[model samples]
Target: MGSQELEEEELVQMVRDFIESESPSSPSFSSSQGLGTFNQQPNYLTLQEILGSVEDTEDEVHQKILKYLRNKNTAWKTTNLKKWLVMRLRMDGYDASLCRTSWVTTYNCPGGDYEYIDIMMDNDENGGVGRLIIDIDFKSQFELARPTTSYAQLTDTLPCIFVGCETKLNKIISILCTAAKQSLKESGLHVPPWRGTNYMQSKWLSDHCQKVQPIPRISSNNS
Candidate 1:
């Protein structure tokens, strides 16, 4: 066989290996037991739970979410359940479509204790762009009062969530930075004037909303 044939054979074998093998890193929410079991009062709180953010499970990194909060089965209202389902999808590795009324949560990975805070976006309806979910694991924690289950950890990583297109998601890191600031505000948290909620501009803050902060671009080696 020629070198080209050998390369093709290797690719085929690799594909087969992936199809047959399951990696431990991937998440599977296979439990329907406690899911959507919350009451009028939504129980528990995760960054996603609080924010109502969406994500695409295809690229979502759910493992990064703290373990305990990930498996939360509750009896709650349908409205709240909807929110919970949307958040779980982001952390798990599936993207959701908010515009599609039929796009409800799927329990493909049932039997999970908890979920994450990722939001799915409507590309066509809301600027027709994509969003990115980033869990910013903190290198350090705060000394003040915070959610013990959440803020008690030694490292203080901010769960970063933003919406945009591939090119758009890239151009607007600054916008995402602003959006994070807005997220904090929307959740009734205080921030600096510049760090205020971008959602303040609802007209400007739709599904695939993109807003570049007025801050000038600085070339960071890491960025």
Candidate 2:
């Protein structure tokens, strides 16, 4: 088989093994057990119960995500991160919705140019107010740019959950820290009060970085 096919097969097997390990075995009842015994308050597992048993599933999936990005032959791009996150959040019982991709908005500045947010999440449908905007900074393109002239200048319309991420964990933290500082300076804009506060701003950025783990290196055997 080709290397790509082989890698896919390996990933499939790995996921299968993980699920098998997490699944509970069928309960066995004695032959003499009566229907009355079965009806005597059988402890049936709920959806939450099953999911709680696999609480580490999220971490495992995150590890796999990192592995995929670390692969040299993988065609995955920064935008794929948003797609993966949306799906994973849903899987983890979060009410996540992809509001837009490459959402373009115009700047009323001197250039009157346009900019885009990589991804936006509308949590309003899920009983939450406001939106969550994410900007993936894979190669420091956004990080190295002039914030004064970039979309950072358009904070009024930006979502309070605005976050920028890099592939590396440390870099992701650094970029978010810088973004938080900018948010503090521009807090006078029409943003949510929590987002405007320094403490909450730091929490928002730090929390995002904490959720993002570094990609693991693929072993030579897998290669």
Top lDDT: which candidate number? Answer: 2
On residues 87-146, what C-alpha lDDT tens digit does candidate 1 reach at each position? 444334345322211111223211111111233445665677445432221111112223
The count of backbone overlaps in candidate 2 is 0
TM-score of each: 0.21, 0.24
True-structure Cα RMSD, model 1: 20.0
Q: Candidate 2 lDDT, tens digit per residue, 41-142?
A: 212112112212321323343343334334533323223444454554454444444333121222321111112122222334577543233432221222
Tell how far residue 26 is off in model 1, in angstroms: 6.3
Q: Whole-model Cα lDDT per candidate? A: 0.31, 0.32
Worst 10 residues of 2 by lDDT: 26-35
RMSD of every candidate to native, in Å, equals: 20.0, 19.7
Best TM-score among the predictions, by candidate number? 2
TM-score of 2: 0.24
